[model samples]
Target: MSSLVQIKDVTKTFHRGSEDVPVLSGLNLTVAKGEFLALMGPSGSGKSTLLNLIGGLDRPTKGSVSIGDDRVDQLSERALAAWRARHVGFVFQFYNLMPVLTALRNVELPLLLTHLNKAQRREHAETALKVVGLSHRLKHYPRTLSGGEQQRVGIARAIVTDPTILLCDEPTGDLDRKSGDEILTLLQTLNQEQGKTIIMVTHDPHASARATRTVHLDKGQLSTAQPE
Candidate 1:
């Protein structure tokens, strides 16, 4: 498979008063198409930072992040947003769904940025909800759904755009063991059946075990960049 995501000597730093604290330094890693990668670390380990960089939500203070042939770190804000819209899907610990919108409408939100018509966008959203087995709950609000259902809606929203790279931050952090397992299995199916390149951050070893590869990050540095 092709190399879908690449991190070359990537480093991130933040300024606290007069001193610059570094979280990542000279990190190099590559994730291939259809690969499921788990990022593990304790608090302040830079796992979430790495996921943000991959998703183009933040730039590395130094170094480069390349998605396919494009150097994401180098893109301008506007360009990066456009690139992300086309290539990246994001799932977070929180559902981040609009409280007023029904599940179907919430999933349809991402598609609004596209040029697709309302009908076309609805079709896409419905298909995505169906994929997560939520078609029957289309009219339900976030408060009406279970934790798993909400997360599934989040997943459906993320992939409704048909992105090549799916970046999930603490994907199962808010769910019970059974719910988390179900979410993990669903992600596994996405990688195996749909060939979406997934990079996920989690503290759970069992969750990490479900991935094709696991990367450990410590103090923002990739302690283990290669697959395990």
Candidate 2:
């Protein structure tokens, strides 16, 4: 498969008061098209930072990041936002759904930015919720759903835009074992069946085991590992 993501000698640093704290240094990696990759590391290993950079939520202080044909690291804030909205989908540990909106409306939020009419948006949102197996809960509010259902709603919203890649940060972190397994299974299905390139940050070895490959980050440096 062709490369979907490429990172070359990337580096990122943050300011902590007067100190310059480096998070990632000389990071280099590539994700093949439709690949499922799990990023593993202890706390402060820069796993989240790397995900942010790949998702175009933040820029690297040095080096380059390319997703498909676009130079991700080079885009300005406004341009990156637009690029991300079109190409990248993000899932977090917590389901960040709007409380006031039903699950269907929450999933439709991304489509609102597009020129699609209300019916089209509703159709797309329905399909996405079905993908995540939340079709029956479309009218339910976030507060009324279980942890897994809420996360599924989040996944639905992420996929509703039909992004080129899906970026997940501890996607199963907030769930019980059963729920986590379900989420992992859904993510794996997206990678294997839907052809969505998936990159996820995970600390659970079992969760990492579900990935096609695992990459380890330690103290701002990265090393590749085969998922066992």
Worst 10 residues of 2 by lDDT: 219-228
Clashes of each: 1, 0
> TM-scores of all models?
0.96, 0.97
Give the per-residue lDDT of model 1 (tens digit) for 1-228: 789889999999978999998988898989998999999988898888889898899999989999999999989999999999999989989878899999999999889889999999999999999988899999999999999999999999999999989999898999999999999999999999998899999999999999999989887677665435
lDDT of 2 by residue, 1-228 (tens): 999999999999999999999999999999999999999999999999999999998899999999999999998889998898899889999989999999999999999888999999999999999999998999999999999999999999999999999999999999999999999999999999999999999999999999998999999998775325
Model 1 alpha-carbon drift over 4 Å, by segment:
225-228
For model 2, name the residue pairs that clash. Answer: none
Error of model 2, residue 152, in angstroms:
0.4
